[model samples]
Target: MSFDIGNPSYGLVFWTLIAFLLLLVLLRKFAWKPIIQALNERETSIENALASAEKAKEEMARLSNENEQLLKQARVERDTILKEAKELKDQIVTDAKVQAQTEGAKLIEQAKKEIDDQKKRAMAEVKNQVSSLAIDIARTVLQKEFEDNKKQEALVADLLKDVKLN
Candidate 1:
């Protein structure tokens, strides 16, 4: 433990400088190449990892866009189907209304025809009854008039005069 900072030994200093130079030369020849190669390999691996991350980000963005497009297509198809169903519903309602009106009109026409037929039959029956009553009244009046001979003879003379005048 004799540390003399002021009184240094020249021979020891000279040997220490030589040993340091030798160590520097040996490290440069042996350790520096391996260390530099390892650093370069680490830098290349980092670059490859960064590139893979960027590619994955791009792929995620592309998939998100595809999913958005699919959702939009599905919405459009749903709207189209709903619109078609509405149109079909309207068409069916219109067809049903038209059919009902046509049926009502046909029934009305049939009822009118039936009423006309019944009116004509009633009028014909009334005319036949009136004609038969008139004939019966005329036969009864002629029977009463023809009962007495003298009166019947006088009536015959008058009917002959009336016929001759006609």
Candidate 2:
């Protein structure tokens, strides 16, 4: 047989067309069905992944905002605590100073009272000594005057005449 490129036999052409149609139907039923199903599943998975990524991004943003709020609240609480601590410290210092001043005043008052008491005691002692000395001198003068009783009698009469004249 000779090689023919332009035209072939009718029976050969008909058989070839029948075989191609059979192959196309078989591939569509077996191979193409699974391929199309796999492609659909891949598309669904890609969509799911994209949705998950979007949700994760939204969650991350929400968490970031929550963290910022928490940080701000913590900072406010810290500042409030610091302010309270400073106030407490100032109050303590003021109370301590007041207590110290009160104690000092009490001590000064006690010292003044003690000084007054000592001065009174010293004055009493001085008065007692002076009175004792004056009594002793009066006793000595009386002893000397009584030794001259006859002269003391004449002197007594003159004292009585002087008293009557007054």
Candidate 3:
């Protein structure tokens, strides 16, 4: 028998249909199942990565807020310490000034008392010198008066008359 290029055979058509169905079954069992499983795994990994990123972002925000609070607390503490130090310094200066003033007053009082004592002593010395000088002058004057016996007798008679009048 001669074969014609344009003529179709029923046997070839039947075998082609059977071979196509067999290929479908084999692909479904091996290649298609593995491909679908790989796609699902990739999807799950992408979702997990997104969730982890969100958690990391929230943690970063929390840490930032905590740092800000710590900074504010430190500033407050520093201000309080500085204020206390300033108060202490002012108190010390005030105390020193008061003590200096008290000491100055005491020294002034002591100096005044010493000056008064010296003045009293000087006045007493002056009085004593004046009295001694007066006594010496009076004795010299009396010796000159007694040198004249007639005058001395007259003075004695006057003294005796004054004594009788009292």
Whose lDDT is greatest here?
Answer: 2
- Estimate the TM-score for candidate 3: 0.66
lDDT of 1 at 113: 95
Better of 1 and 2 by lDDT: 2
Q: What is the per-residue lDDT of model 2 for residues 1-166, given as tens digits with 9 covering 90 to 100?
A: 7658787888888999999999999999999999999999999999999999999999999999999999999999999999999999999999999999999999999999999999999999999999999999988987888789887898788788888542
Per-prediction tally of clashes:
0, 0, 0
Summarize candidate 1's per-residue lDDT along 82-127 as a digit string, tens digits: 9999999999999999999999999999999999999989999988
Instruction: Return the clash pairs for model 2, or none.
Output: none
Alpha carbon deviation, residue 125, candidate 1 (Å): 3.1
- Model 3: per-residue Cα lDDT over 9-88, one tens digit each: 87877998899889999989998999999999999999999999999999999999999999999999999999999999
lDDT (Cα, 0-100) at 38 in candidate 1? 96
Who wins the TM-score comparison?
2
lDDT of 3 at 158: 90
In order, candidate lDDTs are 0.94, 0.94, 0.93
Arrange candidates, best lDDT first: 2, 1, 3
Candidate 2: lDDT of 3? 56
